[model samples]
Target: MTYQDKVILITGASSGIGKELALLLAAEKARIILSARNEAHLLEVQAQCLSLTPHCHVLPMDITDERQVQEGAASAIAIYGRIDVLINNAGVTQRSKLIDTSPAAIRKLMEVNFFGPMMLTTALLPQFKAQQQGQIVVISSMAGLFGYPWRSGYNAAKHALQGYFETLQTEQPIPGLSTTIICPGRIHTDITYSAITGDGSAYGAMDPGQAHGIPVDVCARKIVKAMRNKKKLVLIARMEKVLLWMKRYFPPLFYFIARKGN
Candidate 1:
């Protein structure tokens, strides 16, 4: 279960959790492929990873674009002739209520958070099937499990993401393929700064909750451990784990608390 020499592809590798994961795996001497829309940031992360392992490569492309996803998947597989793990960590969040959010804004969130990962996973299925053993790590959110205020589109997209990947988990289309869905409550990352508003513009400000969330490096370590264990589902959270329990056993309280949440 070691990461040594394992060819792993991670999306959203420019910064935050993705970058942390890249560096962690690189330290373990894994063959790492970093992907993200920002080439400059990817290069920066690549340089850091290369210092740890010589097997680091960067493939910059927009996950929301289908052509880029397909090409990126091919390029990733061509890197080491196989991809042992694919981490679908590239996603954007929203920060507006459903009523205030425009249709296009919601669509944009769906494209990046839901369709992009699905498209990339689909494109890589053949390669995984050929290898007969591969891991698909999906970075879903706690919002995927239940409703939350000020994140209407983000909630919808994450829920859709969970549904899609969960179905794949049940279907077991690829006998040797494993899927791990990670539902993180909050990790102190700059994700809030890039969160989309009702009109599809960046929120550009960090929320109070994000400021007090778990550390990004801690979250990345937990994710890598979950991937190593091939866990079916993992929730990285504190109070949010309680909220999920409330949702399952105490619906009234769950809704009451959710209504007041940001």
Candidate 2:
């Protein structure tokens, strides 16, 4: 549908998929609220979005910070007193295996990828319940559907997000709220380089698959299309969906191949 007047709040809007999505929505004249930790980058994105529409606002805050999440939610709701859509796009990846991963590193990824988004979603639930209608879109990953080597923590966090949002979709007491989980396999981004390592440091190296992944704008268009359709779950990327089918229907073969993946 047309996002001409829709109030869409997006996390991690400073860069990557979130930034591209913001540009797409802004071109549609949506009232965009861009949230991220980097104030400078957020302002840069805000300027770009404003070139498309005058309804863009910048809300800089780290999703990993609970207090900031609370403040961000309050600030968002205070804008026009409604949030038609909240896109949980803020997340961090991990490049460490379970054996190599530190407990602290795992927790850090969880805080950013799973717990932070949940805190923001929980804080905004009341506003949604009061309004009687809202859409929550989660930008998850293919890893959420199946485990992979050297990404145990990232897999765990995305898996947790899938469970949490899926439960909300099925069990929410309200009648008008709907949750959509979007699983994106890969798109050219800095996520791989920024992923946390075993020692809680950035991996700082891009993966071959990510380097050759789909364009961010193409991924953003697909996401907005799915959002318009109000889909419950969407698996984007051709190769990734095929792999998911194998993982679900041919576990033995999938496992054998996954062991060889990089």
Q: Global lDDT of each model? A: 0.95, 0.91
**Candidate 1 wrong stretches, greater than 4 Å:** none
What are the TM-scores, per candidate, against the unseen true structure? 0.99, 0.97
Report the poorest 10 consecutive residues by lDDT, candidate 1. 90-99
lDDT of 2 by residue, 1-262 (tens): 6888889999999899999999999999999999999989999999999999989899998898889999999999888679999999988888777899999999998999999889999999999999999899999999899998888889999999999999998897678988889999878888888899999999899988889998888899999999998899998886778778888899898888888775
User: What is the TM-score (0 to 1) of candidate 2?
Assistant: 0.97
Off by over 4 Å in 2: none
lDDT of 2 at 240: 75
Backbone clash total for model 2 is 0
Clashes found in each candidate (C-alpha, N, C closer than 3 A)? 0, 0
lDDT of 1 by residue, 208-239 (tens): 89989999999999999999999999999999
Q: In terms of TM-score, which candidate is strongest?
A: 1
